[model samples]
Target: MARAQRPGSPPPGGLSVQDQAPGDRRRDSWKDSWGPARARLTDLAEDYARLLASQDPAAAEATGLPSRTLLPDVGPEALAERNRVERRLHQLVRAVETPRSLTGNHGAKDDDARDSTPGDGDPWGRAPLAVRVLRAHLLERLGTSIDLIESADQGAELNILTSPFQGVRRRLITLPTDLPGSTSSVQDWADLVDRYRAAPRALTGIRDSLAVSAAQGVLPPRGQVEAVARQTDDLARILASQARGDLSGGGHAAPGGALGRDLQVAANDAAQAVSDLGRYLRGELAPLTPVREGVGPSRHACWVRRMLGTSIDTAEVYQWARQELVDVVAAQDALAAEVLGTGSRAGDLDAHLRADPSTGMSPEDFPRWAQGVADEAWDAVVGRLLDVPDGLGRPTVLLDTPGGGVHYEEPEPSRSLSGRVLRSFAVGDETVWPWAERTTVLHESVPGHHTHSGAQSLDPSLTLWQRYLGKVPGCNEGWALYAERLAIETGLLSKPADRFGWLAARRWRIVRVLVDLGVHSWLPVPAEIAALPGAGGGTQWDRPTVEAALRAHTVLGEGFLQFEVDKQLGWPAQGLAYMLGERVWLAGRERAQHRAEEVRKKLDLRAFHNRGIGLGSVGLDLLIRELG
Candidate 1:
């Protein structure tokens, strides 16, 4: 996120001469505010997180489990808990807002203060950067959670799989290893068995909630319902395997003989619960689901806000996607011409590249292949592109999910374990090894998620709230998307084919942004790009149209394409987060770099990168406000 022409590295902390100027108020107050500001932020972060976790157990798992508690009952009970938390958040936000005044200056006499005394409304902005950002974060958190809950329609995101249930299931299974505080393996197994035993009862609450939601006319799209069923069915199989003594399912080795015997039986019961839920989703829920592919304006707006943490005009976003696609096409062509030489058909390059044997590794071989790629990506950027901290990424684990793509889990802030990439290298996506795997690796692992996420977890200056809860999609996903460009910029995409992979990777993002805007807003697909997806132009933004358009522009296989499409249907504007986030990050970098001279300062890439990541996990709006 930062770059400079410094002769060598500046210091141990990466602070420069300009940063430590004798009278530099910015640096001084930045130091001064660290204590009180951090304390307040930590309190805010912990309270908000605990409250949220009370409602959504998975959120707690993702945050280092300060309280190693299983989520309370699901369904309406959990929804009620969330409502209480939401109200509490509003009160907290009001309580913590820095009133319009300043007291003692923060660092130096002329330094920009953190906040003015309680009532003095001097023109200079009140509140420290951290406090302002924290307040905004609390607000953003409430918006995403409460708005989704408030807008509980049949198509709302409170369903069994993609909405919140799947996440809860994942956290529950991973608890023994993921939770802090080490217990003996036998004790851990017993604790896990207890949770396993409790799973069925816990699920009844969720199953009942789903029934009530359906009764109230709150249903999801039929296709999404089916997609979620596929996911639930997949998870059930994994649990069943674990119950039968396949340790891979639970990430726990069997204790053997009598001690492990009951583990298997308990796991069997858990698997039965999971399977029963899957049955409900497929046999009971799908028929009741609506067949519509798009959300109405109100729901769409909520999704946009939910994912991006900012609002944009949907009509403008659609046109922008179209224009962005045209540019992407041109850039790809230019790169292709450079790769293939003059008069060589650019589209042929794609055809030739797709035919490569390496693109079709069998599903059994994908974990090793993906793990190898993760290793290569880490080594490539560890020192060159990022100063990666110790104990970040581990050998990738191809965790079997319901329907899976590449997803990264950062090491918990506890540092007790290494980060593992869950690549549910599902078999349907042609050969699971698509060309974009490298870029995706970079996006999900080193120099992208692995490094960026590690920074978020490891930064000492960040409050626990910011650490556990602050990661907005825009700030983090934006960095990962920007990482793809960085890989290309650094000449990592050496071959024309590799460069094409980069293009294809980004091409899908552009397509996603367009599809999200189109499906939700029903923006009229422009004629210039109507045929843009494939041979015949697209007329409307529907499942087939978006799928064809994606296939036309990207190297994604059929199964992968379908997975992405169905997710887009259920998840809505979340598809836009990657590219939109990358755009913000890219622009923020340029904005800072370009304005460096105006501020009589030189940009520090390491500091810029470090600070950008260190701001914990706030949304892009706060990121731009602070970093810009």
Candidate 2:
């Protein structure tokens, strides 16, 4: 039989299959088969079920995650199969429940709880496409199912004020299946509880403020409000359910059944409290207020700050980022002349980037153009770039406009629509900056998330949690930012303007770190710092000085400023990931590169990167050690 070409390989006319050697042909045949050459995919469905039964049987029953058998090995074939089953599982789960976190203890404490914060330029936060899809499944299956029933607070538009004592209840129980050797120390749980309790007063205050704003004509849409309430009710229920289940010793089979029962009651109590507050908003506060469309960034920031545990001074952080921006812009200016024809106007860069017409071009093409540039970058880096694995699959670039940013969804199981790189289209009228788009692709696709996540799946030795759970934002995103800079240093951005894009992206991260630290840490925002460049010259800001500082430093134009500020306001510590992740990544790389030099061997950049990613998603502190 005539040998075939790799499926993704540029086809016959341009790259002849017959001309290829036998070894290449053999590999291409495997790629062409559309199934992994090694594993028996048939066994995957059963193994997956076994794993789930061992880990979380109740969640398995609720979502059917345990029904499928996943292949045992961590080979490419096994991963491919795992991907397929996980995707189906996700679809089934999302159909049952939305993953949007409602305002409750857990959701309120974590800044990254919002649905919009996924893949926000962080490699770790960027769940593998399989994981992202599966997490949606996990959320739907293991998370709260509030949409099925109305929450008691569903119709209430009031902010319930409760005594701090009412919210200070505590319980300690050893959880069954806390993952073999899971180290959730008593102190950690105690700290989590303490943090949860510390915020009631602040949460109540923010709720009341938002209500006041709403009464004065500034409230989020009714649907959004109801959504928040439902989310809140659902989260409380989930927490309560988990607790109850732990007490019952149900193991994985009755996942969160105990929590469900406990939260069922908690939800009712909270609803009544909210309802009473709603009455106060409409009756006592309505007459004295001015109506508005939604709670703005200021109010949202307050809530986010209370949730995430942060202590960075926002004003100082903003000043630092702004200063860095000046330096970055200056550097870009020097490079622009050499790349964009020496005299290209400042306004021309965006248009120049969008003008590239390449092989994968589409009508008013967005991602294809970006992908082409990224492809060129990869070509430059391959072999010479780093130690890229031969088996790593080529990424599939797709538009995800209408969503905030690019997302790296790992491939589905069964290899159907696998490795689809979903790029959220410029949702709404958010203009796509050519440089921003390409940088995003590099970070989310190339030597960034796509590579990191793929490595995790391929590394069988990693624990399930490392492979799939607890992807705290800081390390993941930080690595991506580092990767972007690494690509630039490696001369991947041959085009000067592309280099500028990388720098711009870096500036974006600097901003995120400063702001994230500011909000969660309760640092003050300086008025002078607030007066720096941003929306309304920072006049629109009325947040804690720290939050205001972060916003002013990270965001530029009015709209971006507003969007990021609001995002940070609603979700704390999330912004910190971009900065913190990058910092750790940069420092670690520096250490690696320095150590490699003293050893007098050509440092394998690819191996270093793969190792970092292969360690799995871990806490930033652990990440530093893993890299070392």
Candidate 3:
């Protein structure tokens, strides 16, 4: 049997070495132009990337790094080591002088702008755009990481989504067996077996950290603990079933063979480990966790910085969200009236659309329909709206596992694998809503994550850290939300039903701001919002009250709505990223437009988009400055 080719090997019929030489030379020239300070930053970024890859195996696999077989060691010793490495990296970053060409006469005067917060330092003192963005990115990112670790926030992070328990199992289940080849080799199976065998140790490390957190009174809420425990139990069952299936005939390895048996035994062991974790969480940890879901003000602020890469005044943001929610609901009501030719209630409009045979699709047709939408979006945007690199091809659309939710997975940094838009549906979810899904496809594929992430991966000017690790949710999710609105502006959502879908999506995000802030920061629910049916009469926000609010304002299915609520409760401040990020994007664009008009020039939308995305993922604060 032929051995699997390494990742990053040219795909069949892809560009040959000669064909790629010109682009390669161009990239080299770009790198050669960097000054010593920039060069030092790039070197540090590479070092950090390697360190992260060694510590985070799931991340390594996601980014096509070499260490895909290992799992993260989240024990106290490992956490301390990581903190030390981050501190040293931070020191080196601070010591590197700004290039004189980049830092004009401003002389790095510290300013207390919203972009610059305490301990984050300032990155906006007359430096060239590139220098300022890079410096700010490193400062904000490293600062946030160090803060989370030091504050014990890292140890207490258990959630429905993005927690270590879920991440380990998800990564294992989704591990790419056919990497660098069309079919798995025996070696590939062996590698997977190795990961399964290592699962117990990795999970033990996580449990140790969580135990420490519990002792320190830094535990996640009881709800999150319970949810994760249930999820772990489900995952254990899936793993066990998977093992038996593989041993019988479901996998590439021969039945009753040594490799097959090894896989079965390893997978069973991993399942048992997961089962043990579930029991521990439910029996020992849940009772100790706080009943109230909120993380309170101080921890909420830390999470805001971690998720958005900027600090926000929670009260101010909450007030803004209240008014924004009002405005969005008004707009949504008008759209509903236009779409249904009746009342302005969103539920009625959604019901009408869902009941319409023309608007519904069978589950079998969902992927193809979604794919067409993605392809059409590509054709509509490229060249006309934005300058897409020839190498950053269209993303593939597929149905993911049940309950996975809709998301975009970035391509392997090497570009050997294309990005994917995974659309998940709950079991028995047979009907697909095109009107709603069209905006989603546009957000996750064409002008959203795939476009942003693919461009970053393909850019030779980016450091490895920027390409693989520089994920600011504010910049990333904000751009996607902006893309949704852009689609409406550009006529992609021209149909009345589709346009209403956009409004529904917009309203959903706006509602998220209120719900996230209300629950996490303990903001009092506004009077008007509290009056809505199902929204319980209380100043405080709770799961039932928030669920009622989501029901009234958004068109999501029950399962997804519950999932979203749980996600917000468990992962504080993350749901705020969409609306808050969009706020910055819109403000940035308007500022650019105003400046262009002042110069008596029309702003070129294509260039504006390409240039902004070309900077790769940075904090919203850095994003606005860089765009200007």
Candidate that scores best on TM-score: 3
Can you write out model 3's per-residue Cα lDDT over 1-628, one digit (the tens) per residue?
0111222456335766567666554433332333566667778887888778877886575555666337776767777888999999999988887433432223233221123222443433443345446777888898898998888878888998887777687656754442434466667677778889999988888888899878888888888999999998888987898678543333444335887788888889999999999988999999898887688888888899888888898889888888887887777678788766667676677777888786688767878998898888888887777866556788989877687378888776354778888888888887888888899899999888878876777666667788778788888999999998878787888998898788788888888888888988888988877988888688988888888888878766787889888988888888889999988889889988997999899998887887788777888777877676
Q: After superposition, how far is residue 141 of candidate 3 from its true place, in Å?
A: 0.4
Rank order (by TM-score, best first): 3, 1, 2
Off by over 4 Å in 3: 1-34, 99-128, 174-182, 238-261, 339-344, 412-416
> What lDDT, from 0 to 1, does candidate 2 have?
0.46
Residue 85, candidate 1: Cα error in Å is 2.4
lDDT by residue (1-628, candidate 1, tens digit) is: 2221112335336776566666654544444444454355557667777775655556666665544445445567667666677777667665653323234444423312334233465322454445555666777877677767655642245433366557547745664555545544877777777778777876766677777777777776677667666766777777788788886734455777876887788778878887787789788987787665677567787777767778777877777788888888887888767767775554867766667776666667766776776677667766665565445544354655536566877676355656666766544544654465677766777677877876566555455666666567777788889888877776666667777777877777888887777776667666654765452354556676777666776665577777677767667778889888888888888877886878788876666676576556777676676666
Predicted candidate 2 versus true structure: per-residue lDDT over 60-91, tens digit per residue: 43224542211112222333344455555445
What TM-score does prediction 3 earn? 0.86
Regions of model 1 farther than 4 Å from truth = 1-38, 55-57, 64-73, 97-124, 153-155, 158-161, 168-189, 211-217, 230-288, 354-404, 412-416, 419-436, 526-540, 599-602
> For candidate 2, what is the TM-score?
0.50
Which is superior by lDDT, 2 or 3?
A: 3
RMSD of each: 6.3, 19.6, 7.3
Alpha carbon lDDT of each predicted model: 0.66, 0.46, 0.77
Worst 10 residues of 1 by lDDT: 1-10
